[model samples]
Target chain A: QKEVEQDPGPLSVPEGAIVSLNCTYSNSAFQYFMWYRQYSRKGPELLMYTYSSGNKEDGRFTAQVDKSSKYISLFIRDSQPSDSATYLCAMTQRRAGTASKLTFGTGTRLQVTL
Target chain B: NAGVTQTPKFRVLKTGQSMTLLCAQDMNHEYMYWYRQDPGMGLRLIHYSVGEGTTAKGEVPDGYNVSRLKKQNFLLGLESAAPSQTSVYFCASSYLAGGPFGRGTGELFFGEGSRLTVL
Candidate 1:
């Protein structure tokens, strides 16, 4: 089984709609959770970061992590056309003084229509 | 700021031909990583470096080699390319992991990406 699993969604939603993207992981050791946004022909950029089991809010985006369930989610409110992109969930166990090995999900594609 | 820059934005290679992808960072980060993205496969780490003169294999390291000769540069080389190796390559850098909360949350800065086609 893949370490992280996400729905490969081409989910189309209208502007001003709320969009929720999620991922599930089997590794209990994963301590850091992240959401990344990738545009066409571009590398993924870090969108949100949270290490705790609650919610973290940044602007219009909210990231939720449920450690017990091994699930993480990113919620976008009042979505805009500019939010159209692939969203990927990534996680890694925190290790001091070393490189953290990150495992990424297949990503969920989202489109916001006008 | 040019956080991370990858060279040869696009290229096509004949099977068995070899080439190297270069990643340079101006952030002076202590960590660097190389990942490849494919349709429905997401991004898989190829190799990574914790500091200059140090290199380590990642989840997908076969048919690839890496070098971190300089603190600001990382190189991923395909000794002999294959069709399966054709993918968009990304290079990223971050501060050392496990810092105090809210700082350097392992947030990675990435380059645009290098698209390689093996025909």
Candidate 2:
């Protein structure tokens, strides 16, 4: 099994709808969880980051991590067409000083239609 | 200010041909990384550097080599290109900073990307 698993969803939603993307991992040592957004022909950009397990809110985006279940999620409120992109879930083993390499999931493609 | 920039946005090469992808970051970050993104495979690390003059192999280092002689640049080289080496290459950098209540943390800033196709 892959270290991280995410559904490669071409999920389409109407404007203003709430969208949820999820990922599951088997590694218990992954402490740093992150969500990245990649537009067509562009590099992945960091959207949300969380340490260990907890919930973090930023604008219309909320990221939740459940360490016990090895699950992580990103929720988008009042989605818009501008939010359409590939959402990638990534995580790394916690270490001191510098950050370690990230293991990523097969990103879920989101299309928020107007 | 260009956060991160990659050279040769697109390239195509035949088998046995060699090429180098260059990455430059002006953020003066201490950590830089090279990754390749492929469909269904997500992003795989090729190599990384913690600081100037230091380099280390990543998860997918085979058929590739890297050098970080300068602080602002990291290069990924394919000595003898293979069809399997074709992918979108990305460069990212991060610096240790105080995050969320004085905690030492960091986040990656990525370049646009370099698409290379090896035939």
Chain A accuracy of model 2 expressed as TM-score: 0.97
lDDT of 1 at B21: 95
Instruction: Give the TM-scores of the predictions, in the order they appear.
Output: 0.97, 0.96
Candidate 1 local distance difference test against the native: 0.92
Per-residue lDDT tens digits of candidate 2, residues A1-114?
A: 999999998999999999999999999999889999999999889899999999999999999999999999999999999999999999988577765588999999999998
Clashes of each: 0, 0
lDDT of 1 by residue, A11-48 (tens): 99999999999999999989889999999998899899
| Model 1 chain B poorest 10 in a row by lDDT | B97-106
What ranges in model 2 sit over 4 Å off? Answer: B97-103
Q: What is the DockQ of each candidate?
A: 0.76, 0.67
